[model samples]
Target: MTEQFGLFDARGLQPADAAAPPLCVRESRRARRLTLRVLPPHTLELVVPHGARAADVAAFVHRHRRWIERARREIASHYSLAQDRLPTRIALRAIDQSWLVRYESEPQAPPRVRVLGDELEVRTRDASNRGADAALRAWLCDQASYHLTPWVLREADLVGRRPSRVQVRLQRTRWGSCSSSGTLSLNAALMFLAPAVVRYLLIHELCHLISLNHSQRFWDAVERFEPNYEALDRQLTEAWADIPVWAHPDARRR
Candidate 1:
């Protein structure tokens, strides 16, 4: 079970400084020690192990206050708070396509998105950014499903391994995953990565059909298909910075 606590709670913990960003404390049964995470766009999460004393948790935060501030600064440097607003253009690099986004307001009507020649037209009720963002995200998922599903299928055939099903979604922490039952899941955010990087990710997941764990044999299979897997894997990790802030999983939360 997990529970969340705000900056100031009833546990007699020290109150957070007035200028400090929001802090969320979560209790985890599996955690052996307190760990801190600086989530993107400005949220701090502290994971507390079960049965931790409130005083200890407070001291932990106090001890790491400077580190927290530094991490926040790094995130701010990479992501501008102003970019949280609606996007005017989107570039799907994997497909080598760029799209212009146009917004139309319709009072009391449901949000909708349409794809024109090189543009995406979003119609939303009240013209709110939230509604438009949702519509665009839905459209993005559809686009991912349309392109990534077939791409995974073709790659599976080439690798001489097949999956029971392929799914595309807007995942936050993973590029792709394969289950023991042969279900392959791909992140919709792959659309923002380079074509070569996307192909490498697909190959990485398909290779899992041979070995679920990252054992020596699993890595051997990956190298067999992609000799430069190490470099491509590094590129995938760094590509997150290139993704539009609006498409991030935490964007809507802000």
Candidate 2:
């Protein structure tokens, strides 16, 4: 079931079934056309251009109803978050390291996570799966900060480019993005990708600081830094498949 929604209406769009996957409606100022995204967990998101009429949106969705349903079915049939469980032994190829994970349960204790040597340990008061997910994400963020920040700095220095700032976030669709102000935003999932892929991402974003788009100049600049960037870029496109289901707790039910 797909929950239907319009961009604007007096009482909003019609209600959907309780079992229906949520439908998100957003208006994008930069959008020149209507766009549909079938995100993880079979969620349907409709992006309408700014000032799109409600009647038009309704008709568009009606026309694409079958396509949306098929997409939802495909996603539900193929992608399973249960397969993404956090393992007791975790390998981070981007940083060339392996981790032995241990879970400790303590009543009335706050959830805590730490890394020692090649081992990662999580202490939790609540025995729920959600607690473990939170603990793991916290640890991943810590590791991403420790490893990715310096990697960016060293890579930037290689090209003699100094970004204004660098930030790490758990982004779903993109591995990294560079703002016009030279600020680099990296995905925490980069820790799961290969070293070459991670390096390519750093170089790719750094190149954006110079060219800002995928113009010929950008490729030329990227080549100056990484000769094998084209292959690495292609490899990066499939890197999301390497990220385990545990990495995305919110999409677990889907």
Candidate 3:
């Protein structure tokens, strides 16, 4: 279940500001502790562990009030939150490709994405942008898989470590992850980043095959593979601002 809170202070009673953003509190079975997520556009999500009291949730939000405010400011700087707009052109910098996006309204036809040379035609049944967004996300995943799979394999060869499998997804909080089973999961949004940053991420994950934890040995391995891993890692974190707002998961939620 989800609940929205009004203006409140650390004590959970006094109104901090009338313009304060409403906080969405959600209970999660998998959550171990109260966590805060500032989603794109300007939505604050508070994740409460099952059985957590309302007071704890309120206090958690209050303690992170400054963080929430700063995150909102950063997001506002990076994205135009006024409306959910579709992209007229999509650029994949990692692969150095761009495509013009065109849309067609077909009330009776199911939503579909068609590739025509350097253009993507999105045919949608829904009047809202939801259908088109969904179609584009699917297409993006396919494109990521097609390009990233081989890329991962090639990097694996260079690193002398082969993953059990490689999967590309539109992950919200992670750029890439490697499971104990040697499966590498990469975020589809990597396509929006530079090739060097993407390579650093791949090396970072592939190095996990050597050491899963961020131990000194892990960093050593990462550095061995990519000498400039530190700078690249920082660039990867900042690259979130470069991703088009349409590609954000929050766009679909909106």
Candidate 4:
């Protein structure tokens, strides 16, 4: 799941192109801003201050298309999702072993999935145009709560600790994470997996609260909660690879 558009994202894409809906996500650092995030499915994001015009961002993207495209090409997901249309269904093979495929669609949308019994399943319904992305994103957040809450509590109880809060949201890079202040951030994407796999992410993040690093002790902490952490980690390690074709980073904004 790649955000084709957002506030100040810095990925370079021109809306004029019927090939792909391009937009940029803005990222700033040290008050000197010029970072653009080309979102997945291939697009550009322009990084600017709080008050920036989309038109100005578009110009910036036009200025940096080469760098962005290079980065997009480096990311394997973009290559996989080069051709797609809005509100469409796409079938693809997931590189992750946990689940063979996924159906990204609107909330409570029809069962776009057709299970052929273990072979593989992928039914994607695009809502990128009419806020289907928003709908799918909301469902993903709720699903994360439904799946991760108990798992978090279970791990906390085992170590005689309780989490002060749980945060579930979309993150392009991380599957699950935890903070030292007893707050946990989990990727809503876990909803795509079976319950067992979700449990693995829970223990892994909670253990971070204790060890704070991926040391042997941290792994041991994870092992204490789920003995098969290594195996589960292996499964999750390569997940999210089946994300569909989108676009490449705009050449102007990298």
lDDT of 2 at 12: 38
lDDT of 1 at 79: 55
Residue-level error in angstroms, candidate 1, position 23: 13
Q: What is the C-alpha lDDT of each candidate?
A: 0.73, 0.71, 0.74, 0.52
C-alpha lDDT (0 to 100) for residue 137 of candidate 1? 80
- Cα deviation of 35, candidate 2, in Å: 13
lDDT of 3 by residue, 1-254 (tens): 22112222223422254333345444444579988776544445566775667677776766877887776566554455433678899999989999999998888888889999999999987667457877788898899999999998999999899999898988654688888888898999999999999999999889889887665897899888899987787687557657666676645434
For candidate 2, what is the lDDT? 0.71
* Residue range 1-254, candidate 1, lDDT tens digits: 12122223533332244333444455544579999886544445577776778778878877997887776566655555544578899989889998899989887778888899999888977645457877788888898899999998998988889999898888654677788889988889899899999999899888889887565797799899899988887787556556666776545524
Worst 10 residues of 2 by lDDT: 1-10
Q: Model 4's lDDT to the true fold?
A: 0.52
Q: Residues 100-214, candidate 4, lDDT per residue (tens digit)?
A: 3344555555434343544323334443333333433454456457656776788678866677798877665456666667787877666655556677877777777777556
Q: Kindly list the per-residue Cα lDDT of model 2 for residues 1-254, writing each as its tens digit.
A: 01112236423332253334344565544569988876554445676776678888888888887876667556645555353455688788888898898887787777877788888887877444346666787678778988999999999988788899999977654578788788888888899888889999999888888876666897899999999987787677546567765665344532
Sort all candidates by lDDT, best to worst: 3, 1, 2, 4
Worst 10 residues of 4 by lDDT: 245-254
TM-score comparison, 3 vs 4, better candidate: 3
The list of candidate 2 runs beyond 4 A from truth reads 1-65, 77-84, 252-254
* Worst window of 10 by summed lDDT in candidate 3: 1-10
